[model samples]
Target: MSKKLIAIASTGGHYVQLSRIMKQANFDSNDILYVRTKVNANDTPSFENESLIEDVSRDTLIRSPIIAFQMLKLILKHKPKWIITTGAMPGLISIVIGRLLLRKTMWVDSIANTKQLSASGRIAKKIAHKTLTQWPDLVGENVQYKGRVI
Candidate 1:
């Protein structure tokens, strides 16, 4: 059997954090896909081999069916077995779609010093196969602490 396909974050802090995890996980570079909203022309070399998708911002994320449609397309194209994220809106959409498709999904709430759980983390708890928090105390029964991604 082939190794499962994995999707990782694409931009901002989420992308940076996910990149570290992916490196540690030593996931097959070809089997990993990356999704991000902002693409800097100069940063193209960073994601040369992996599949890439633009993340839709929070304000327009769920409000637009296009975002959902795009997500569905990626899910179909990649057929990933695991979807992991760092609490971004587009990443949340991927988690939800992966769940609906019965894929294994992991959502890691961002470790930024915010007292509240992120919108992505909250929604992911309701649907994801696992909700991992960097801070053990903030997690409820539905969420688990998986140590800091950093």
Candidate 2:
């Protein structure tokens, strides 16, 4: 049987963290697609099973709608069994929409920044099928501490 499809993160700490977890999953490159803000213009590495979206910063009002449309398109096209992310604007939106669309969702808060739970992590606690936190003590009843991402 084929492994279930997944929508992975695209850039920065979230991307780095997600990449680590994805390596442990049974899914292959074709079984997952990446949704990131933007591709590094200089780093032209061959990305076979990835897609990019404009990175939505907190200051941009238009970020949500653009990300929503892109996420909707990817959800329709890929039909992933689960959507996973680390807290960030785009990740938060993806988790919410994924739940609404009946896709299993997992949110893992970044471990490096152990100081606080992100806004996305808080929202995910309310809606995600599973809210994964790195800090055991920081996890609430709604959240699950799944250990460090590394």
Give residue 25's error in model 1 in angstroms.
1.2
Top-scoring candidate (TM-score): 2
Superposed by TM-score, candidate 1 places the C-alpha of residue 116 at a distance from the truth, in angstroms, of: 2.5
Residue 38, candidate 2: Cα error in Å is 0.5
Give per-residue lDDT, candidate 2, residue 86.
72
Tell me the TM-score of each prediction against the true structure. Answer: 0.83, 0.87
lDDT for every model? 0.73, 0.76
Mind sharing the TM-score for model 2?
Answer: 0.87
Best by lDDT: 2
Which residues of candidate 1, in runs, are more than 4 Å off? 1-3, 40-45
- Which residue pairs does candidate 2 place in steric collision? 37-55
Global lDDT for candidate 1? 0.73
* Tens-digit lDDT track of model 1 for 10-81: 477888888777788888787777665547544453554454555566666555466567777877877778
Q: Write the per-residue lDDT of candidate 2 for residues 1-150, one digit (tens) a residue.
A: 222555556478888888878887756777777666676655432476667776666688577888888888888777888888875778888888898889999888888657667866777788889888898878777887867878
- lDDT at position 40, candidate 2: 60
